[model samples]
Target: MMSGEVVHTFGFTVYFVFALMFTWASHIQRTNPGAGWWALSISSAFFARLLYFALLYTGDTRLIITAYAFFIVLEKPLMLTGIVRFLNLPITTRWFWFIAALADLWLAIAWVGEFDGFTRIAGYSLINTSLLACAAWLIFRHHKVVPGLSLRIAALACLALAAHWLTAPVFIQLYPAWATTGFAVGTMLTLVQYLSLLTAVLSLFQKRLLESEARALDMAFLDPLTGLNNQRYMTTLFDQALLLATRPHHIVAIFYIDLDNFKPVNDKAGHAVGDEVLKAMAQRLKDCTRSTDICARVGGDEFVVIGTQFTREFQVEEMARKLLEHVLLPIEVGGYTFQLGASIGVSLYPEHGNSLTELVQCADKAMYHIKRNGKSGVAVYGGETAGGLGLREA
Candidate 1:
């Protein structure tokens, strides 16, 4: 059987390695307060073990034991505090200090009273068990929010370590001859606890990296002002719609809308109010289209709506009329009321052109045709005008 001193030396080495790893992590992630606390916690454990190993050869058992007990009692409270901070759980500073003080007082009482070895060990072991159990409970409670296999494994390791501590006193009393073996097993459990916690921290960093990438993608593909898909994303949607249009009885319709009398709103009321108007217009466009349709802000005062899977050409005309009616509504912004109008040009798949660029060009020409005749109406690419519903007569 391995001696107790050998097990202590091995435990010291484990704590040292973990201390260095946590210190490096904290240095790299200076913004992560939890990492710093974890580094401190592990470093305290490393120092306590180092102090014990150093005093082993001094031949003064009382001084060595007292120093080790004083330093070791600090480890659990610091670890619990680090766990709370790392998980972003709400815990008061007073509570942390109170727990630390209580642990210290208990140790002082055991030492001053000259308690038996078993009594001292059992009391300290129970304290450690409670702290480790609390850490495991905290991690388990936050599993849903900070989800990862590593975190779950860490929680399990903590619970196992706590159970080991809870059984340490009984094992030591029942099988004094096997105390060395128990110490060896506890040291292994402690090593596992350190490794799992380090991996769990790395997992948290990975989650943050993924979320940042998603936000960047959103910024790249979406318009900042109106929250609509930009022209770049519209091309992708157009290609998808074109693929669906290849099916029998399926048609794609594009409505190119140019706001009439919009420039004056910007020139007179300032760009801020003009932005509000554009946002209102974007919302109206969304309200007028189906959820399957795509809406995009392609240019200044120019928007596009693409509808797919239409069975009939008349449905396109009806959709165009709905858009015209919605655009003609009065917009109220900043205590000012303004009536807006739109010149809408419609293009159909296989009738106007094949590609988005070609169809948009055809729609642009038809929109100019409406502007030449009279604004605030819809015109098809093939000279068919949708005239009704009190539209502006040309």
Candidate 2:
């Protein structure tokens, strides 16, 4: 509805605004793969439009027109490449760059050789539409796997932009009044595309936020060094297992494990090597314990294994032997082989104590009894220290 000059000026303003906004956004997310490319594409497109209006107002120059046409044709491919990178898809660098270069060359030749206005328009429309169509195909093909509504909308926006460019030449040829209204229509279409792109950007930020929160939650419950459950996580499982132990014929076994002569390894080799020993031991403990059992690293050189569903008394002893055998195996760390040993003290539900704290204290006392007699051994909680194998008076 505005005059041609006003429409053209406002159109330039819109492009400049989006260009600046995307540029700022790209800097904020500079680490992201496709952000920089998309920013450059948007700014280049804005530059092309600015030059087009400048040439029309002043004396027309074929070279300047060619440069503007080059950027206009270049925009879609840049955007498509950026989208592909954003989606983590493989890029065929050779074929894509070759085709883009050849298209630009053709446009340059056409403009310098004095091609008619309709010929130039057709050339740009065909190339730009084809590029947008390719982008749409890529988005649609991957949409189901990613399953984002914003991505779907982005693909539809690409299709709509392609359709607009494809029909532009025909509309100009058929309708004599198209020249008057063409700028307004082009500006509106550009606005729609810009808004769609903005939506996709917001969607990406939301996805990143969700991923960060999940990582934080996982870190809360897991030990980063040993990749095992922490003391807090073990306590939660212990409480749950305690409630289940109230049923008939159910017994919960707690093993308080300590690494024997472990400080010597840290003194001989640096803490880095000692860390490797701990990781290797953690893996071995996980392998020795049954799937129903929960193994946790509760201290620097202390671990715990809680097992439920103990049908036989011998099963716990058998597991303790396996734990000792695995931990005794020599581990290679930082090109040095070191022998490791473990002392475990086991306490059972109802037999040792009813509560988790009582069971742990019982197990700890039994463990210290083993440590006092010898470094590496397993002992069960007996009636009392005076009465049996390894236990304190009740």
- Give the top-scoring candidate (TM-score): 1
Give each prediction's root-mean-square deviation over alpha carbons.
Answer: 4.4, 5.4
The lDDT of each candidate is 0.80, 0.77
Please give, for residues 169-274, the per-residue lDDT of candidate 2 as tens digits. 7887788468548767767776776666665665677777788898896698888999888888887788777766677878888888999989988999989999
Cand. 1 TM to true fold: 0.85
Candidate 1 regions exceeding 4 Å error are 1-6, 28-31, 58-64, 105-115, 149-156, 267-269, 383-394
Q: Which residue pairs overlap in candidate 1's backbone?
A: none
Give each model a TM-score.
0.85, 0.70
Badly placed stretches (over 4 Å) of model 2 are 1-24, 27-33, 36-81, 84-120, 130-156, 177-196, 267-273, 311-314, 330-339, 350-358, 382-394
Model 1: lDDT to the true structure: 0.80
Shift of residue 65 alpha carbon in model 2, Å: 11
What value of lDDT does candidate 2 attain over all alpha carbons? 0.77
Report the lDDT tens digits of candidate 1 across residue range 54-117. 8888986555656766666677777777777787777764665566577667777878898776
TM-score of predicted model 2? Answer: 0.70
